[model samples]
Target: MTDQVNANSYLDTDSSNICEVLQILGAKWAFLVLNELLRGPQRFNQLQRNAAVIKTQSLTDTLRHLEQNGLVLREVFPTVPVTVEYSLTEKGSDFQTALKEMNKWVEKWGKPQQVNGKTSISS
Candidate 1:
């Protein structure tokens, strides 16, 4: 019989600290929301329409999570009707640079593959 071992057991270095940051950013719909806000501030409806992949409740939750993590800034205007807008904070801007770098890495080393019966790519 062959010995069973966990893949992570072979790695020598610990990345638990970095994993926490990744965990926050790696949530579903988080990156998409950030992408929408990258260009400029957007209203809730705009983001909802742009990210059709995300459910409204999930998007709202992701936005709150980003805001709590200092990656998004929510602004409220007191007019006849309330106007709420979301923008990337300075921290979020820095995170965008990191995302760009990640994109570059994927472009260089990733290849298209079939994942879960769906065409996808990985780096």
Candidate 2:
């Protein structure tokens, strides 16, 4: 039998430390939420609307995850009725720089393509 070659063996896993970073940011709606916040702080509803591509449930989960990760801060305004808004924390701002670099990489190197019109990417 012929030897089977593995394509991934050629890659240096350590060089892709950013993979973990991207994984966190790659969660559904996470990037979009960050992109929205880049514009400025916004209410929950605004985020939901801005990240319309993500399901409402997914967006909710993404926001909670980001908040838990200390990348996003949730604020409550004391008024007759409480108003909630989300803004990026210092950590999140630092992450934005990474994301910007990632964006530049994408612009220079073509984005991953869809195979057979399928919407997902496989390892």
Total clashing residue pairs per candidate? 0, 0
> Ten residues in a row with the worst lDDT in model 2?
1-10
Query: In model 2, which runs have C-alpha deviations exceeding 4 angstroms?
Result: 1-23, 111-123
- What's the TM-score of each model vs. the native? 0.77, 0.70
RMSD of 1: 6.8
Kindly report which residue stretches of model 1 are placed more than 4 angstroms away from their true locations once superposed. 1-14, 113-123
- For candidate 2, write residues 7-113 as lDDT tens digits: 45435464486586766777767878888888889998888888778887897899898998888999999986889999999888777787778777766675566
Local accuracy of candidate 1 as per-residue lDDT tens digits, 25-122: 97788888998899899999998998888999999999999999999999999987899999999998788887899899887778988899997668
| Top candidate, metric lDDT | 1
- The best candidate by TM-score is 1
